[model samples]
Target chain A: MNDLMIKASDVGKAFGDRQALDGVSIAVPRGTVLGLLGHNGAGKTTLVNVLTTMLPPDRGTAEVAGFDVVREAHQVRSRIGLTGQFAAVDEGLSGLDNLVLIARLLGASTREARARAAELLELFDLVDAAKRPSRTYSGGMRRRLDLAASLVGHPEVIFLDEPTTGLDPAARLGLWEVVERLVTDGTTVLLTTQYLDEADRLADSITVLAQGRVVATGTSAELKAQVGQRSVTVTLADRSDLPKAQEALERAGLHPVPAADTLTAPVTSSRELAVVVRALDEVGLEATELALGEPTLDDVYLTLAAHAA
Target chain B: MTTTLTAPRTRWRGTDVFTQVLVLTQRSLRTLVSDPRMIVFSVLQPLVMLTLFSQIFASIANTPGFPTGVSYIDFLMPAILVNTAIQSALQAGVGLVTDMKNGVLARFRSLPIRVGSVLVARSLSDLVRTAAQLVLMMLFAIVIFGFSPAGGVGGVLAALALSLAVGWGLGWVFLAIASWLRNAELMQTVGFLAMFPLMFASSAYVPVGALPGWLQAVANVNPLTYAVDAARALCLAHPVTGVVSALTISAALGLVGWVFAVRGFRRPL
Candidate 1:
């Protein structure tokens, strides 16, 4: 309990007739990342707002860094930093001035604030643009500056709400690397992302939300396992060979479903690909193409949605 | 980068509210100064008013029942300052709405600083900005328009201070409106609607007695009338009763605005 940096129990929130969050709960331990995976309108931002003390829950409670969000909001605020969905830097101020302002507001002396600003500017590779107003920065630069501003206080826990939502692939990768570095430095993180690959890459555990409820929660591997097997598909050279191929695969203890000139069979792992090839070769059946498919976060969502309905 | 990550955490003693307000005020002031165009436009509107009103209404001072032996510019100077204060105060709400739309206010909310600091800093910075605009207008009046007040420099300072007090009080009103509306365009529309009627109906442009019966009744009850009349008294060395009335009204207005603004600000976005 003491090691958990973020803990929320049965948190619920509603706006008018709409339930933005309903009985959602999650816990993230110290120095680990909790990936909140959800689509739009899935209560991702609402929960972030609650845990960050920007909004109180309609029911239940939450705690961050050992402080209750509602009762000890100031304590929670002091221990956490939030980079909201939108980049929240002062566009009118220079990048350096923006960072220095945060540091000063957190009670740093003039020299100390400047020093921290300079350090963050160098770290985020904004040294060249330090004196330019943040509005002049590119999208990637602005997001970086926003993240750097949140880090000015050296917060114990960081909430990044879709930190790379609009970035190109290269920029997304750059931000991912930054998050990875922060995790390495022993900071706890709660990241909300619509991208499964992002969650798979960053989160120690993933919580999937749909329609303001937690539809699933587990390690990425565990969630993938729940969605079931990887599949192998083989396209035959001739339609006549399909029956023989199916028979061969069946004898090899594989279930192959055939359609037209193709046979697709679910397999536990990639190693089963060799089994299909060897079995088909024994019957002199040639294949034009062979492919393997891994169950993705999309499959998990579809499966969950199907189950819910 | 590693050094910063590994740097020992500073003990989380809370920041003094005064320091927080000062720092946030500095941020607002810095943003204002960096935008030369904004400063230019803010001053230009009132300068145009000063020019147009002093020229067009210069003859009214010689009319029946009007105060004699003083140029219309002197009479109009204090009123213009009051009007300028009103315009500048409207920006307080507009600025807050801009911050809300741009997400800076959201970031500020997530920080550990006292929530009231944001509102206080907003009004304080706008007051400083209003002071700058008023001083420039005063200099323009003295140098360009050959305007001289009978109450001398001390009275001029008192008038300027009174205008600022009115602006500060009104600043909170707009801030409260911004907090409730949370839409910059809507806030501007509402601010203009409230401001125009108050400005025109007051004694700022013409003596309340010279107005139609209905408008004079409205002007008599309008807070701006008291503010403008009080500022005019300070400028021309009239009785102190209007000044006392204006200050008390402003203080009451400030108290009410502060309560509602804080409540509205605390509402979840």
Candidate 2:
């Protein structure tokens, strides 16, 4: 039982002349989630492929569950599960059969395989449609089955590549809940997603990959603190009150930036909320609307993306 | 329902490679059984071709240099059989390309099983399909066109076996090509482009001597010719030269194809 379930050092991969991954490295501790965030062609999937043993890196090294991905791929494979961006369950086989086949491949007896398949179907809420061909399943159900198929072997580490990319909101939440449960039970996970909110909610730490390189890595809060801003927006009833509101906030030691019929100011503490009200009231202006905004991961992402560009 | 939170196993007992390949092969076979329309269509296409060729080539028997007493249908049955096997083998490659495009190969690669088993299972499944299709083609030829093998039942079985060997061997070749291309449309185009040349230049349809000097040279070197010639000898109860030579070539070519296919499979998708 290694504490670091995954470790890669300066792994590089190229397809022909195009370098898909350039000196990327990642490590995930047991029972935690590491979200790899990147846009398309940013090498998120390529990195997952390398870690899952589906592809060998051209340079450097990677290990999963303490086994070298190249020399000891079989051992690494046995301990890891992977749910790719597309649902990889067999389209020709029924959901139940797909799960059972994977179980049998993992060395389960026929009886045990059946039991595991039944249990997984129930867990994924796919029992009702288990006997139907997976090609007939809706996108969400197929994704669920693909996830269930990977879990049949009870892998110690799971790679989920854009698991919720095409899923509807409800289905996305369902998958997130399932992943959360897995992590709570000591399963280490490396999740790659395009959705910042998904990583913000589910990941313990986030790694941003841009053009085949890691641009940033930290907890969501830490990332926001680095490049994100907190602000309070005040909307006045009269357009003429804008200049007054701006001067009031600036005179009160707060810098308020003005927009059309409204003003936005950076706030470092909650005390600024009271300061804003008192300053605006003293200036003989009554506000119509007020809002306090915390810096979101989206802002952090945009800032980092701009810097990288 | 309560979800189990069992701790992950440190290291489970690994299944042997044979069992893994068998399991995957069984899965492929199950898909074949479930798709009745594909099976029916696959068998029907060859039967229809057999009928068309037997009727269309009825005058080839009168061509003097054609076998003295053999009907054109009998001489042509072996060619059609070998052609059908080759065509069916191409389907295996098409399936592999489809699997790669849809990420099915990625899923299989992530498993604990030997990676080579995936290609082996696909080739095995195609071998079985090719054998079944050949048997049906033979039966239909026997009843409809009065086709008969002079070497009796054993020779027919041996001929059938050779057709399957060609199927198995070429199935690997197609698999290798498909894995390398990783595109179904591209693989299909390449397969057909490659297939027409191989089948037409072979001695499957006409005697090598009857072909022009240059085409005769090509047929002499083509492996499909040995296979069709072998089957023809078996059906006519002729000397076994073609049979022995065809089997030797098939084994050697099959070995080469498997090596290339496995190497292609091991490459990154």
Candidate 3:
């Protein structure tokens, strides 16, 4: 029963001749967030759509909440919730009305629908905007309402497809906090996003996809190790020694980042620093500014995308 | 089908279908109620056409093969009643195009709702709105134009049923149109343009045989002609058999439209 909240085996989808997802397999452990990191058209939405039963996969099988997506799609749907990128609240209806409407559609009784809507509105910081038409709400507020609508059924599993692409930083953080609270309550989340920092902050595990296949999947630290580059930046004692610094770095199999004017080259270890310094001294090079740093998630994303392509 | 007892594949209970329909209906209704300009256009424009055409053809009873001495308002009332419903159904496609553009339809598709809820709920909303249109036409005919049914209560009911059927028929047709068109703004332009000429050129506002040669040939194929002719037969005089045939025709048109709508929606967007 604890196999996973979501399990897919060789799930593939295509539009006529063009493949969208190619034999992709992923497992999202229960009560944890698994981030699907991909650029647009990387088959993120296609995977979500297939799992939610909106589009059937051309090949392969997926299950959500222990129910097969194709055979028990409705049961899967009932157990899971989705918050699409766009705010899908009925813009014509008030915020409260929008939540209550979906709640009722999920088969809640009238009193329960109203109480649930009220609680959700307060939880999302939308109590003030509850009576106003959703068409008039701000983008962040609308996104909150959209996420709140997804919670109407008390789903065990939730899918958030780029929930914060077009929001201000504060709004994005607010949504992040709500997601954090949801996870603390043991909700399993499958989040797909283009933002590397978002995945870094929220995901328990990450799967990086590119060009229709999973290129890398691991803990953030583990995936970072795959494209091994931690940089140590150094400024020269004399600008003339820049010529000598270039040779020392090349001999160590380290390359400088293009925009760094001083010196930024890959470092194997802090112990190896003595070897580099000695090599630099022999080559007549010295530094004034020096520090070592691991690669950022952005660098990892780009390298993975480029490698897959 | 070995899974009948296997805990219904969908969390969707049959009763939830009604709630879904109601929610969708309320959303559609609220949008319309909020938009005063649209409400006015939907209600008033039909009434204007009803009066203008009736007054213009007040003396049409003098023509051979037409009912002599029947009031033009009475002759026009039933057909106009049906016309108002059919027009609303036909134009209901615009809302679908709007939903498609705004991603409302796609969101519903992704959710755990019943299959066909979106389309069925939209048509059901159209049905209610068209019924309101029917009441407005009835009020105008009775109070302002001094028109009442000479065929009595049964005739009025048959008239209502006929229009509702026609409205549902064209509603299905518009559903197909909305599904096929990618850009909704373009669809609105095309839908409105298509409706005006088709409504005005047919026996809806004037007898089709009275039109110029080219349009008369065109009206021969227009389905609205059959609907209006059926209503005229029901309200103004006795040709019960003709009314029966028109009902059959309306059913056939509705079936064909449903086929198109299903074909259009069964495939992925």
Candidate 4:
């Protein structure tokens, strides 16, 4: 019931000459998800490693579930479960056996371990394939089994490192639903991912990392707002009318950028949708398609990437 | 799913380290059991070597100063037994490296279990496997090669115990190296590189006098030579100071290796 289940303060780690994490600090409150967004080698996994006590920070301190990760690693470890980018379950063992082994290691009795394994198999939709070796399982199935393994001990906080990185859309949604359920039941989560939409949908707040530093941290709406505003996109009836449309929009104090046949301009609000219509009408042009589009996480990501570069 | 109680909370209970090590040992033994072919092949290689070497070196017993009381196979059996045990110990390092490479060791580290359990469990299970291989080789020496020791079955059992002790000690040394290297091929290369000299310079195949001046010096101090000499003495029904020294060295090596192995586990991956 701690308010902040995970907190890192000025954490720094370096490998050889390269800094994998530099002054990276993040706080994840209880019963909330902190979505870590970053490009490859952006220290997302490195941060996860530090928080989970897999690696200690070179300069600063990190704590999970109120236990200092380096000094009280055992306590931190017992409270947090980590599912890496790749499934780390024992592939040679059956899914059931894998869960049972984890449960047993977590201090469950033999009978309790069997019961818990059976229960997790059903919950993860892996009951039918429970008896089959995980090596034979599909990618999605193996991923679920890995998640199930982590949950065998009912960890208070879960660190999912790109949990849905390679899953099909359906599998990703299924996994997301499982995560949503866990959060609803009050489990803290720190999820690192390459998918912006996954963060937008699942995260209570997002922290964007670039070059091992926190470039931005906010709610999805806040991040999107920081990048820009809701925009109006216009598609003209004639393809050659693109320049005229762009000029008309620009003349009305709108910044227009042409992408293929469409011209889009950022607007402070949906009220500018009328300005777009009026400008086009004043130029004696008709629009085939005109719509106001809200700024998405993708725009925020692109803007961050541009700023970092 | 509804019937299941997903508390979504950590109980924070602690399991004893002894139970954790025992559970992990069970896992290692289970994996070893599942791969019967590996065990069979491991034992088979020593059987082949024993047979080939006994036949090839039978003529060496006719040399002027060779031990007169026993067939060449009797002397060679103790050497092969030690060799087999050393070979089996290599598996400990290889298994640890494989575990590290596959992230299984990482998974274990993430848990609340004791850090040393992984190495201790591997060494324990390997000791059992090496013991089985030693016994199988001893039976082959007795039945197929017409080999008989003056010390009888008790002496044979004593030799088996000594070989296993030596192998267990060496296995920890390799496991320590594996934790640092985290590469199976590299571990095997280093282990064999070190093992060859130890085996070749030891009193396994011949007396220390049969070696050259420098090698005789090396063979005199080689730990494997003491182990083989002790086992050979036991088999000849005249257990000597060599037996006491061998057991003491094995115990000491096991302790030192264990400390290094645990320290290796404590180091970051």
Candidate 5:
């Protein structure tokens, strides 16, 4: 059984009478990525702050890496690294200097700090520009440096709160590789993102939050199952055969809806495709196009968000 | 058959607080080395004040009973050092505010580091920088004016000690201001305005007796007067009372400033 890296029990937070998080509970197993999908003001960052021990929750308990956020804040902080939604590295310091500074802060010797900084520089592919002022680095380079700086002490758990929101597709892919390597090395990741594809591609388990509460959560396939199986699309060649094809689909226990020249119907199984093809043959009709799949995580995300509203 | 220890160790010694604070102080010091402009301005401010103030009052020292037998240059050296240190300390809050606004301080807030060390490091860096400037002004005072302090080595040491204390004490005021006020402009404006009033209304340039009755009373009451007076006595070998009194007032300010800064830091703005 995988060990639980983070466990929150009815965690609650309020900022000046406005409830930012209300009894939001989440748990992540070690070495697994839990993508927290939420729109703005969904309390993702608030929860991250509470779990990271940066802010004390008004109610309930949160434990990260076996350390209680309130009672053992220092230990909790030591175990996790937070890359906030915005870049926080000092612009005056060079990229190399920023990474080394964090290492030194974690009690690394000067020699070890420099050596580790060089290693991270190579890992982020910023070795050549490491000596330049961080202010001059490109947005993508700064983001990479920010991540590398956070990893200086090799934190066991990482909170990447919208880590790739502002990066282009190429830069986003580069960060994804770094995050993948971290998870592969047994690092537990609590990722929050606005991008649905990011959650689908990297999340081992997903928690959808809306209006500061978790609406639905499960694996991508399980959440997709909540939206039911996808509809099989079929385009009939002969217009006159639509009525017959529709009737044949109904006889085969399928509900067909005519969409332009194509007829579509929800399918409970992939075998429905073969059944539909046979039905088309019975109606003297041929399908010009045919496809069947399950609903995507996107569908589940929208459905859960809509319901939460 | 060996067993693996999968979990991280839990025992923490907790005695490394001072060491961590020292390391953080060194980090700020390292940044200071890269920014020489700050050093130049910090040193240059006192130098200009010293020359301008002493020169403006050169003709008056020729009169009798100037409090000390020393020249106005020697009389003004100790005050200049204290004032410089105080200014440096007050401005130290600006750096803390900058760090907070820029997320530098927030970085430490996220780490498992000593929270007090974050503000302490900034103040320590400012103290060191101001000390260098104070020492440089001392050299200038002695060279340009051909003036010698009454107690050669010990007096200079005492003067510097009193100045450091004043600077460090005022630093607490800045730290408190920086903690309570989040905006850098507000911090700088409040510190700057407060520092100048304290500087001018005190006996930093001339003896309190030389001023009008009301001005004399106000200057006499200013704690900065104690700093300047104590430093002057120590530098002129007039008496150790000046040094003792200055240090007493500075120590009190330091204690009060610390209490307030911590209180402000703990409470929300």
Candidate 6:
């Protein structure tokens, strides 16, 4: 509890008849990134709101940076920064003005605020577009500015709610790099994203939410190992060789599923590749292509989603 | 590279509410002035009203019950100021709704600042905007129409101050509405519905005595009527009869509005 930057226990929230978050618990330690992955309406934003002190949970408690969210909300707020699902910058003001306004709100003097704003603009590579209204900024520039605005207070903990939801691939990668730099600087982060690749790359640990419940939680490799499988697929040179290839693989104690001209078999080890080769040779069958594949985070996500459904 | 995360966690000493309000008011004012077209249109509406009403109703000044020595422009100018104040006050609500919709207010909420500061800053900024517009409209009335109030510069200044106070008071009402509704389009529709009747059915267009009996009752009870009537008296150098009632009503409305606005704003978005 002392080392944890964010901790929530049995948190619950509801809106009328729909439960937005129910009995959800998560703990993120200091100086690490916790990736929260969920589908739309899967209670991602609701949990972010609760932990960031924007909304009080209907049941249970949450603590951020050692302050109880409900009882010591201002203390929690002072130590945390939040970049909401939207850019959340004042579109009518220039990027510089937006950062300056936040800095001043956080009790920085005008000179200090300007200095901090300039530093963040430089860090985020937004110095060139700093004088323009955020409304005129590209989506990526706007997001960078929003993130910079959140960084003005040098908060120990940050909550980024779907930070790259609408960004292009390059922009998403740029933001991921920024998060990596922040984590290196010892800032704890709770990032919510829909992209599994994003989670796999950035998260020290991932929590998958489904219908206001924690469906799964683990590291990327651990999750992939849970539902993911390694396999070998062989494409036949001739369409007529599919049946022979299937029979040859079955004789080697491998169950092959044939689709089109390819036979795919789940394998426990890489030695099964030689087994497949020798089996094909014994049947006098020639293969066009043979490839081994590793399970990806996508498989883990799909399997979890299917099970949750 | 400046590393911030390892920096010592400073104990939270509460930020001054006044400073927070001032900082946010500057932000609101910056957004207001950044768009020249919005400023132009804000004054344009009253300029159009001044042109249409002063010309069309110029004959009313010569009628039997009309004030003998005052031109229609002089009497109409003060009422137009009050009307502009009402419109500007409604804009305060619209501005809050826009912030709420665009997520800026959410950012403010997640910060450590006092919640009431947002409402206060909104009202203060809109009051400043209304002041600028009123000054420009007054200059237009004096220069373009060659209109001079009988009460002179001091009287006109007093009327301007009264209109600003009234506008600031009325702004709280709309701010409360904005906090409760949290929808820009709905705020506009409701604003129009409320403002249209309040502006026309009061003493803004004509004297209460000149109105029909039913509308006269409305004009009598309407707080805006007192505001308009007081402003008209100050501009026309009358005995200043309506000042007490106008100030009292504005204070009462402001008190009620502040309570509700703060309550609504403090609730979860």
* Predicted model with the maximum TM-score: 1
lDDT of every predicted structure (CA atoms): 0.88, 0.84, 0.76, 0.84, 0.78, 0.87
Q: Which portions of model 6 miss their true places by more than 4 Å?
A: A230-309, B1-14
Q: List the candidate numbers ranked by DockQ, top first.
A: 2, 1, 6, 4, 3, 5
Model 1: CA > 4 A from native: A229-296, B1-13
DockQ of each: 0.41, 0.43, 0.22, 0.34, 0.17, 0.38
Clashes of 5: 1
Q: What does the lDDT read for residue A96 in candidate 2?
A: 93
> Residue-wise lDDT of candidate 5 within B132-183, one digit each (tens)?
7778777777788665878677887788888998888888877888888877
Q: Extract clashing residue pairs from model 2.
A: none
Chain A, model 6: TM:
0.78
Residue A223 accuracy (lDDT) in model 6: 72
Instruction: In model 5, state the lDDT of residue B51.
Output: 72
lDDT of 6 by residue, A1-309 (tens): 379999999999999999999999999999999999888899999999999888889998999999999999988888888998788899999999999998888888888789888888888889999899899998889889988888888889999999988888898888888888889878899999887788889999999887899989999878766654667889888988898888888889876767777887766678889999999999898788998877543345445644554
Per-residue lDDT of candidate 3, residues A1-309 (tens digit): 575999999999988788999999999988899999888988999998888887888899999989999898878877777888888777888899888877677777778779778878877888998999889998888888888888877777889999999999998998898788778777889999988779889999999887679888988777767755655677776766676687776676655442336766555567656666776777766767677666654456545544554
Off by over 4 Å in 2: A230-298, A305-309, B9-13
Q: Positional deviation of A150 in candidate 6, in angstroms?
A: 1.1
lDDT at residue A303 of model 2 (Cα atoms): 57
> What C-alpha RMSD separates each model from the true structure?
6.4, 6.0, 6.7, 5.9, 8.7, 5.9
Worst 10 residues of 1 chain B by lDDT: B5-14
lDDT of 2 by residue, B1-269 (tens): 35663355433545888988899999888888878577678888778878787888788788867888888887888888888888888899998887787767778889888868888888888888788788888888888889886877887788788888877877878887877787878877888898889888988777777888899889988888889998888877888788778777877767888888888888877
Candidate 5 residues A127-207, lDDT tens each? 999888788899888888888877776777889999999899999998888788888778889999987679878999989
Better of 3 and 6 by TM-score: 6
Q: First chain TM-score in every candidate? A: 0.80, 0.78, 0.79, 0.79, 0.77, 0.78
Mark the 10 consecutive residues where model 4 chain B has the least summed lDDT: B3-12
Per-residue CA lDDT of model 6 for B1-269, tens digit only, reads: 75453243443333789999999999999998898677679888889999999999999898877888888999899999998888888889999989988889998987898888998899888988999989998999999987798899999999999999998888899999999999988988998998889888899887778899999998888888999989999999998999888888888888899999999988788
Candidate 1 lands at a TM-score of 0.88
